[model samples]
Target: MGTESSVKAQAETQIAAVTSLSTPQEGQKNRSSGNFSVENLPAGTYALKFVVEGANSGTHFNVMKDVSGGTDPTIWSHVYSGNTTDVQTDRSFYIANPSGTNSNFTVKVYALH
Candidate 1:
């Protein structure tokens, strides 16, 4: 196959491991709050994007990326913690991806503070 074809194949394989959040469970901490996860991600950086539809007044959501260590067979290290804001009016944000194998991602929602 050609180089372009090979690259496209690799990208497809990587994207296959990425999953989007279909449902967010209401958090016990707050009634307006909720959480969701993107599970079974491969070892690479992924762009975390989201869209919030039908949000009531004073409701907002944020997508955060957290990562653990990929080195050493021992303890895991928290490499990064970055967040993107989605105000009720804006309703969207793009957060950077997590880097590591089997790392988990979460989206948190709450009343505008």
Candidate 2:
């Protein structure tokens, strides 16, 4: 195989470790999961995946990135919004929340490249 083809093949076979930003829980509307630090990880775009599991129907989710460090954290960016899953990319992220009643959900963060 050519050099370019070899690199592409390696990347395709590599599996990124999935980090759970928050455990599965019954989420409340407008309630934030709070700021999480990805400072230890390398600087690269990451895919934030949110999955709604259990008995929470009609539940929606949203994500924010690079929240301010303070008593009241400010959202730097709103990267995602959906009910089942969000594959939005961001280098830094802070919060993920559910916006419907009885929201049993979880958010998984994984590096993309």
Candidate 3:
């Protein structure tokens, strides 16, 4: 919040971040099974960034957030490369390589709450 915020800026909020490593049975990687839950987040919008390792399945990845506590695969807000987007209205975020396979992966979120 800078020059146009309706409410006066309070204080410098601490940087919030989390990292998770995808685990799929016995040391292998697979899609749809490797996801990290974004829990204990405050009620506000957040910008997310990701770093994926061992990308053997695909280049294009979709980052989705589970607004609800349940890990419902059908309902997710997804973002990716070539698509300009930010600040998902949520209390939790989830990230994973939907097309990834055969390699261990990790996703980190430098969340601005």
Sorted on TM-score, best first, the list reads: 2, 3, 1
What would the per-residue lDDT of candidate 3 be over residues 1-113, giving only the tens digit for each residue? Answer: 56586764433222233333343234523233334544444445354444444554343345544435645353233433223335444444444445444444444444444
What would the TM-scores of all predictions be?
Answer: 0.24, 0.39, 0.38
Give the residue spans of candidate 3 off by over 4 A. Answer: 1-46, 65-84, 89-91
Q: Residue-wise lDDT of candidate 1 within 38-109, one digit each (tens)? A: 434344423332323332222233333322342212111222222222322222222222233232243332
Cα displacement (Å) at residue 64, model 1: 6.3
Task: Please tell me which model should have the higher lDDT, number 2 or number 3.
Answer: 3
Residue 12: error of model 1 in Å? 9.0
Report how far residue 9 has shifted in candidate 1, in Å. 5.5
Residue 51 accuracy (lDDT) in model 1: 28
Give candidate 2's error at residue 68 in angstroms.
6.1
lDDT of 1 at 53: 31
lDDT of each: 0.28, 0.39, 0.41
Over the full model, what C-alpha lDDT does candidate 3 score relative to the true structure? Answer: 0.41
lDDT of 2 at 35: 40
Error of 2 at 17 (Å): 11
Best by TM-score: 2
